[model samples]
Target chain A: DAGITQSPRHKVTETGTPVTLRCHQTENHRYMYWYRQDPGHGLRLIHYSYGVKDTDKGEVSDGYSVSRSKTEDFLLTLESATSSQTSVYFCAISELNTEAFFGQGTRLTVV
Target chain B: QQQVKQSPQSLIVQKGGIPIINCAYENTAFDYFPWYQQFPGKGPALLIAIRPDVSEKKEGRFTISFNKSAKQFSLHIMDSQPGDSATYFCAATHAGKSTFGDGTTLTVKP
Candidate 1:
């Protein structure tokens, strides 16, 4: 298993509240990604970072933001939570174009 | 638009049966194809992967058949066991980015 850890394995928050999920890696991979998994949608990329402070938007980046301040930590923030944002989130890390290693996953529910 | 498409939203097979999952991609630039297996409550893990230069590759009882010209790939599990039941995802990668399929839930009944 990869040395990836996601904080707050489960979370429940009210609508319009702020929430942030953390992904920490000990592998020192160059790339880290945030993804959400839903019943029919599979895994949808939310955001990814290539290096410290370098980030890009994924297919479903709306209403979510991410920051990578160091090589080992990547953060995903939802400025205002919504019911539609309820999903299982996964964090993955890889070395440039190689196979990605995923964390256990974070389940967040918005009430 | 989805860059990669997968078929058979779910599958059921008896023990010792062979199960196949198919995936298709429209992007010609995709050079790497990988399959992931996820058990209930766990994140996905890499099961098998293939590069377009080869038509087929096998690891253990798992095989990946690739048809670059047809823009398609498939995973075949030989003599699958009840423990093989899980969700499978197909992915395509290019330039450090990956697109995943909707996923296939496989059930190998005893």
Candidate 2:
């Protein structure tokens, strides 16, 4: 409902392969975040963008990278996929530090 | 280390029963606390939120009780229905950054 869309709702890749997920938003929010959800880890932040070309790493940033060239698009890339990286990834948008609206989610599996 | 800790990894209750989830945090800098609900195959959505300045905040049948001194907060669903069965997460925010609890899976039987 927040006008957020994540491309490649589901993906399966082999280990050592490259994978990238995209997040697009229409709310013109300044804050965009990428998170991964696992069985016991809950939602762990992967990366976040505060503005165009302004991004920061999160708690679980290892082996992952993110880039935001525009206000509406945020990208997360797995340089080399690993079995441990298999999880549901979520994209969220927020006007500020307040309430964040999340996308449906992207389920990725690495074998 | 986990910034926020949530209890009761899973719960089950009969329809029309009250279900409560508790969370504790060690960071006093956290000023905002929010609860999120997620159904199977869906992303988590905001259910309710509260600030440290307030002792309690309610939205419809959902309530957030906060105690700044105790560094804890809890979510209560009154007369919960089967539709309310879902995984719940509690999060703390500070300086635009947020830390979330592991999550609690709630099952409401009719």
Tens-digit lDDT string for candidate 2 (B30-100): 98899999999988899999989999999999999999999999999999999999999999988777899
* Top model number, DockQ: 1
lDDT of 2 at A110: 99
| A-chain TM-score, model 1 | 0.99
Score candidate 1 by DockQ. 0.82
Task: Report lDDT (CA) for all predictions.
Answer: 0.96, 0.94
For each candidate, give the interface RMSD after superposing the true interface residues on Cα: 0.7, 0.9
Off by over 4 Å in 1: none
Tens-digit lDDT string for candidate 1 (A8-76): 999999999999999999999999999999998889999999999999999999999999999999999
Pairs of residues clashing in candidate 2: none
Give the Å error, residue A54, model 2. Answer: 1.1
**Model 1 iRMSD vs. native:** 0.7
